[model samples]
Target chain A: MEMITSAQNSKVKNANKLKKKRDRDKTGQALIEGYHLIEEAYQSTVKIKQLFVVDVERLDEELMTYAEEVFEINLKVAESLSGTVTPQGFFAVIEKPVPETTQAKQVLLVDCIQDPGNLGTLIRTADAAGLDLIVLEKGTADPYQDKVLRASQGSVFHIPIITQELSEFIDHFEGNVYGTALENALPYQQIPSQDNFALLLGNEGEGVNADLLNKTTQNLTIPIYGKAESLNVAIAGSIVMYHLKG
Target chain B: MEMITSAQNSKVKNANKLKKKRDRDKTGQALIEGYHLIEEAYQSTVKIKQLFVVDVERLDEELMTYAEEVFEINLKVAESLSGTVTPQGFFAVIEKPVPETTQAKQVLLVDCIQDPGNLGTLIRTADAAGLDLIVLEKGTADPYQDKVLRASQGSVFHIPIITQELSEFIDHFEGNVYGTALENALPYQQIPSQDNFALLLGNEGEGVNADLLNKTTQNLTIPIYGKAESLNVAIAGSIVMYHLKG
Candidate 1:
């Protein structure tokens, strides 16, 4: 076991910089925080590079045993690496899983989801709905961001998320790709379920980009029955995902 | 129209304090920010007590005409009253709607949802799913908080929200009351659709308090297919809400 007492420790500073997208991309690693997330990672067999605990005595024995390297850090140092208001006393630096090429039956294609929370929620929902693969386009928010990770509630570790040009993926995809849009689209429930399909959810403000929408096999809309102008993208996406699941 | 320049202006100071629950309850008013929220409030027939705008020229004519009192405030004053990171140059102080007791077909009873964002999302989903009324218990997050408002995306203006004791409300309620729980609960999908029901969602951590859960007609759980411990409360509630809709 190692001990890190200073907030200015090089490792602590480096972990803090993982908050940025560029740093995460460069290192191909991201920080996972809180007991729930760390537990999920260990149980899922996600490779954890290092684990830092604010209170080693309070850490779970299983997690301590599973971690590749465990370090006891001062509270101040632990807090410096956490993005949450209340640090959960556990943090891990894990290698971003290299997503395998998937020919999965059910797929979710996320297009330009900007809000970290919404994107994370979509990931969690997809996982629960038993979607096999999630493909993110360039404009989508980083799934590895701390807020996104927290919002995903550790489903990110359980699901396979890969980033690629959505157009290329759609072109190569052998299944029906349904894009959600408000205009000239059949109600989602009207779209009969099939064996395998890809659902494309759009940006918060903008519907799926024109190019992608043009390429999708069909467009779908979740009926809104109230005075709300539109449903939140994440909610709409999740509802449609569940409704269309085979 | 009156022009207010100083951040310390009496009206400005008072509105800023409304961020606190005590002040909001004392005044029976809450601050609504952003162009979209202001627009929603104006169009939803939600009474606007005062409208404060950074640029009168940019203010929509109908909103200015509809407000009981409209003030043109300087940029600094607008920023001072804003709870968001980016002020959208529109602010309004609106009287909270006095919800009418409803015996509608579909209803949602929120027990003690602690996250402002989750509570707001649930409200929005309930509205979108066309549930008639939302009853909040004492310990739920304040919907008037800026974060909840933002997350709701103005659905707060469209929905009827009332706070009551869960036990009391359930005792007098005419509909089937379903509580969500993880233990010994039937799958939500297995619960047959009903014409009228009250779905009760509990605290984020503790779940529906044991007392309330014990009182429900039946408990429901959304099955998780992935290794993720559980679905987000809001998402789970929304999924069930939509599924069980009459």
Candidate 2:
């Protein structure tokens, strides 16, 4: 395997930047970590920029077939390139091309959920519900961030994603927009889950803003039976997607 | 605000332990940061071993009433006490009391979810669904660990949680047991989501072990309509909880 000891190596420096949200934002690229995540990136048919595989001999022959260019790096070298402890012994630098968000027949809108893991999972759930696009309004975590990408399991590659001015985008689509609220809203299941709908979710701490709520066609809430103040944003979004689909 | 800067100080040392999973496990304590999370911990009526508010005057009057013993720690002191990014000017040392896990007719069994955030969200969802109790088998992330505790948002304090051998616990649970899977499982919505049934979940990556599959009375999966290979495990668990409750 080729040795990469110098932390100053250009590739190493770029991979490390992915750990922070700001660098990820400025570069418009994400570092995909772990074997499965990188595999999913390839399987999604997203263009691969560079693949850094540690212990290259251990990689399955099938995965190697998809690599445009593969770099063999030792575990120590990979660790220097990792954002997490126990780096999956490998990572990839994928150019984050803004996805081609299709015309919204049915869509999903996410307010600034802030937590990287939560946002990623919401995108995964949205893709599963067969929603057309995910719009990341202000205050949301970087979807292309390494943690968010890993949480999404490469669904970001397949799903159409757009992060832009929310009000302008919502005004353009104007379909049946439903937002989840804690109280004073009809039960999501009771509301009759719709097909061509854009499910909007707000930040974990605050529900959607009044201005945004005024824009929604309807305000809906998942009934909470127990003592919990609310559900995790990701879980809430997923449950809403399921009920609204059926 | 009382400023204590020495890392060797008793409180500072205790809070620093929270950064490591091992120390948090050994002490049976989690150092919760931020006014919002700490306030939620109090509002939930969870017992706190100690309250470390960085700015006492900044706290809402309602919250100040709850801290029986509030220590005002300075920002520099708070930074050394903080487990995460620039301390939110607040911290708390909460005794991770093991909840009294009642043997009910139903429960949620976690096999081995490794992500602390996912585990915490699951516990929160379990509480929301009004499940009987939560049982975490070995290999699961420690529920009392700081990250999981934060994610639970005091739901850990509200719910009855237990950790033990999976095979042994399921062997005695006296109701219908369902596990999440891909092919063999019933559709989540199709099954009669029972309030008195136990739900089982597996590791995020490897999934449920083959041997454990025999122990479950039934297997269920949230049907995916789009391109994702699988839904996030925590979402999968929460969706099943909602369906079972319905």
Best by lDDT: 1
lDDT of 1 at B230: 75
**How much native contact recovery, as a fraction, does model 2 achieve?**
0.68
lDDT of 1 by residue, A138-160 (tens): 98999999889988988898889
- Residue ranges of candidate 1 with Cα displaced over 4 Å: A60-62
lDDT accuracy of residue B136 in candidate 2 = 88
Please give the fraction of native interface contacts (Cα pairs under 8 Å between A and B) kept by each candidate: 0.65, 0.68
Error of 2 at B160 (Å): 1.6
Off by over 4 Å in 2: A1-31, A53-80, A89-91, A97-101, A172-175, B1-5, B10-49, B56-80, B89-106, B209-211
Q: What is the DockQ of each candidate?
A: 0.65, 0.63
